[model samples]
Target: MSRVTPTTSRSIGQHTHDYAYYRTVLANHALPAAFIDLDHFAMNLERLRQRAGNLPIRLVTKSVRSVEMIRRILAAGSFMQGLLCYSAGEAAWLASQGFDDIVVAYPSVEPTDIRAVATQLRYGRAITLMVDSIEQVMKISRIAQAEDVVIPLAIDLDMSSAFPFIHFGVHRSPIHDETTALILARKIAEQPGVALQGLMGYEGQIAGLMDDVPGEPVKSAVIRHLKKKSIVEVNARRQAVVDALRKDGHTLRFVNGGGTGSFESTRQDRSVTELAAGSGLYAPTLFDHYRAFKVLPAAGFALPVTRVPKAGVVTCSGGGYIASGPMGKNRLPLPWLPAGCRLLANEAAGEVQTPVQHALSTSPATGDPILFRHAKAGELCERFNELLLIQDGQIIDTVRTYRGEGKSFF
Candidate 1:
């Protein structure tokens, strides 16, 4: 894929939404259907390209579980080069879809999944497995050797920082320093069926945690400080591991780093060959609080009002699409369109029905469209079969998500 520099530098939330337009355009569509604003998606593509600078991005598949949408985004720009799939099985699935340069971002010890990746490798597909321990390396090597194929592997580097009381990043890989990384690398070299291809360091503290939140000044300020500190520590640890591995004569094909939130800092590391991001494309509510960049809200789902309980209140059928993480109010789906609807505190969003409070000034009759944005990206796709592609106030086309294709890997 050839890189095309986006001639831009700015942040935009993309669309000017109107509830009447959505209700009218999607009059005949289903009650609860997921949709993507094509114009906003295109603008987000430009925004991500600008954030990445010249570095190509390996698209993270968990944030975007739609094969059709992934194809569209990859075809949209050359800056998007490969897939950073979340599972061993997902890597095999993508390889079957003709996607190459894939690195399964998480390690798997499942023999069936490893053999699936080997099958793709036998077909000349590039599917690299992720390993952080000697056991994972041996498991993959045993499966690949049994299949009679030499599989490429990438080491998952733990980029978390240890503070006084708090451990900064997600507990992903056990390989925190150069010593553990070299230990894993030596194990990979000893295996005849698996070759070391690259290293991946995901700074989740800097990348996934929200720093510029509204209303909580003290928390946000503290988060910003920790993020700033974590960036320096992340770069140093990643650099040390890369330098030591290279000095030991290990040829790494790529050093993957960062996510949507850490693009600015992660791009500065010369040791990193590419960045990984996908949630920015969909622009879920979790990504809305970042100070540096604001991507457009590209995807959302709309629910049809079932009944009008009061003048300022209405109930919608089936909305309980909460996000994964620690249980909090932020995990709930955000009431989006009509500009005045609010989720009731007592019930919140429910499995069968959701009661919402609206402004008395605006009346919402029965059968009106009540739109909502998910707390996270791609998880919304798991709820719906297809996403209605919207552009210029019209439903252009309907595309299938990974769930729509009857393929769910997680």
Candidate 2:
């Protein structure tokens, strides 16, 4: 099932029909239900492949919570290798489900999750724990009976910025200095049973920012500048860190970097062997901000209009599917179909009955479907048990989410 690259900007018309199908399928279910359009989802997946050029993509499960969807996308190509999981519990769950190479992208503080991951190492599931400090190493080692029994690990270097007052990214990974990175990599190398496999540095500031968007010019300039600076600075530093670590006598199995927005740029960096991407598959709202690519809105959540506040105002139940990030206008969900709607300021998104102001007011009556795009994807999918798989504008089948499977590793 190789990804079929789109040759034009037009959407696969199946999405429109998929919308109708879900209206009927989730009719009995609660309002404000969220789901993915498999057709568009597939297209987005293929688009990533086209954009990736020759580099392999590691699916980020945190961006798409549906395990079935994850497996389905991986089935599309052998090119989609491994997963950049967010939690140790999720890593263990994904591993048990038969995914061998799972990288817990962020450093974990949960002793229970760490122990759960350690328990899976006995089954030959190769889980890579991310470390930036010796404390993290000590924490994982203390949970397990022996450090040697712990699964292999990778080092996460902070690639945000080099110069003070010119910060260009997210504040992550304490191993920012090449000297510190080398020392820590050496320490991990010395630890028993823990193999120092790779290094990961995510440039969220550039990869995640939506520069070159039509309206936000000033902000766009800053983003573009920061991105260019971050790439040059981070790439050099990351390579230096890798070089220094190797000089200290460490074997680098892999050096993972990049995100959905950074596939091309990250691939351009000779030091980064493989990059991770998950949000691009589903084309979450956050990805809409990227200047490099335009992924179709594959995943969307539908909220049923339950109230007619006014002739112009239609309200849907439980609109509270806000994305987790800096709180602002962008954190709120975007109005998708039946345009001309805006989220209420005080209550950007509501728990139930989210009022919308759209020109297509006549188009939607009580019980009519109004599609809402989450500012971020997957997080909304967690609220739903199953996603209606729509193909060629029809409901092909329904698949269970990780939540529907009764798995909540988060």
Candidate 3:
């Protein structure tokens, strides 16, 4: 497969035509009813690869739930680095699949998952467990010691705007400030069995926030301001904590930061050794709002047009698959192509059908494909059993998601 580039309005039309052919082929082959354009996916990956430059991107498995797709991308180029997993079970599963470098993004509360991490670590897998508090440390340590296992660990620092108030981003990690982060780092460093490998800071406001959109200018401005403040304050404070840890004789191996959206800015920071990226693999509608760079709409779901009540409204079968974030119309699946199509006010995305309002020049007949891209990437895969990999407007192969593989790690 050749490297694909980012799509514009011109190329997107061609992609649509290509998708029609791909889906038709799949239908003829008796395959499951889902499609993924590999050409677009490859282009999306390359777009991220070019944007990231020299910095290696840790594939966010949560964004791309298909293990085979992850493997396929990893095989694409060496620029792709390690897996940034969401769950401990995912890390363990990836480790079993011969993935050496794996970092569990969130702290694992499940004892069974922790034990699995310990087992993977015991067998010489480079799996890093993310910890935020001493309580978290104690919890994992107890399980580790009980299993007589020694493992590597990374401290998760809460990278959010903390100027006048704690009013931005997700309230994830407790280690936001230098003092608190250093204290936790010290505790982890003192732990005999576990090794403090590095620090992981996720700037969600800068990385995940949508900077561009048609309306909501004031909200977008606020998000941009928060992101600017966060980059300056968080970077300084995070560096301070790393310095403090080193000053106290801690040898930090790596400092991980950023996501797919903020790769360029994060890579400029000398403090961050490696940047995290996963969502770019399948550029969702939420990511479409960014102004800095453009990525291809790699992943999408086609729900069959099941209900058409009026000349202006057409409802599709099974489209209630919404992404987890602030709920609004933006969270709903966007109707791509044949422009002027929008989601209905009463029912945004229904369980069985989503009514869309559009001025179709030629009234769309029943069974006409309504391609909808979710606001977020991997979350969409969870709703589907398999992804149809399309190459050059053709269905080349079909791959199973974690759901299809019977591994619900989440």
Candidate 4:
């Protein structure tokens, strides 16, 4: 079934989703529950489409772990194509649930994991595995041949640019240059039971890092400058590899790049066929620092205030949904809503209890729901089994997360 887009030119976060707004909407709900504001979610969907321009977007499954949510986004428009699955086993599971055209984002050498994906190929599922090395390609090829099914594969390129004192990107794939990428792609073209389906170059520095952070003009400027330089090198390197492959008479099914943060820049590369984005759908706190586009905090958890520790402090029950990354303050969840509540410095979010400091005027009373946005996206789903779907100021429905569906692949 087709879905409707529910958004307008009006501001999404400035005045729409205030504390009082959700309080009345979720007054009857339980505490420590995750919820999606369908209105804002629709706006984000529109925002993603607009930013992507003509490029198709492959949803990153790691950022959105809910089956229902994924279905809704895919139904949002034809611009949404396929999924960049995090695990091979999970990709096969999604295939079992009737989703196709899945590409596993990471390479797994386990024979059992490869077989799980090969099993899906019998049904003609276009499930492509990611490989960055000849060994990875051979491992998958051996398993694919054993399964008696042809498996497709996408090559992951390391888009990081190295400088004197810094590595300006995340440490991901090891295939860093056109020669290295061609060597691997050539291996795939000659290998048995494995075909070169596409290439994916995740520019983590441009996609994952924030450049316009508040109160850090110098730092932000430095990041922006570094990103500009990295983009030129990244685009050049990616083009070189794509050109080399096509010159070798190999056809590419697709060329995927970037995250939501880098769409504006990534889309400009002629070598790119599509871009990947998912965190923008939910817009966690970590996504707040991007300059190109601002997405609303459409998804968050409401923790019921359990106690008033002081005149200006309220403690909520169970919120420690910290995102997986290098441990630091940025990985901590942001205390949203109530307008003035902030997590304590000494004790930010705790497993059993999270104490928040707030202005007296905006202080939350006991039993009141304290709204908080997670640092990351899909990881939040791992905490809550279900998400309360809110729309038109009412609880429209409740959707099960991947965890709720008895599927935890990580």
Error of 3 at 44 (Å): 1.6
Give lDDT tens digits, candidate 2, residues 147-196.
Answer: 34766789998978855666667789788978998888778767665678
TM-score for each prediction?
0.96, 0.91, 0.92, 0.97
Runs in model 4 lying further than 4 Å from the true structure: 1-14
CA lDDT, every model vs. true structure:
0.89, 0.77, 0.79, 0.89
What is the model-wide C-alpha lDDT for candidate 4? 0.89
Candidate 3's residue-wise lDDT over 1-410, tens digit each? 33334444344332334434534654444322556777677667767777887888888889999888888888877788888899998899889888889998999879899888888887889988899889888888788788787767898988777567556777888887778877887888677667788889888888888887668788777777777777777778778888887887878888898998788778767778888888887889988878787767778877776778988888788888887878677788787744677888778888877888878674666777666788888998888889877776567677899999888985
Between candidates 2 and 4, the TM-score winner: 4
Per-residue C-alpha lDDT of model 1 across residues 299-350, encoded as one tens digit per residue? 8998889999877899999999999999999999988888888999999999
Error of 1 at 380 (Å): 0.5
- Largest TM-score belongs to which candidate? 4
Q: What residue runs in model 2 are displaced by over 4 Å at the alpha carbon?
A: 1-30
- Sorted by TM-score (best first), the order is 4, 1, 3, 2
lDDT of 1 at 327: 99
> 374 in model 1: Cα distance from truth in Å?
0.4
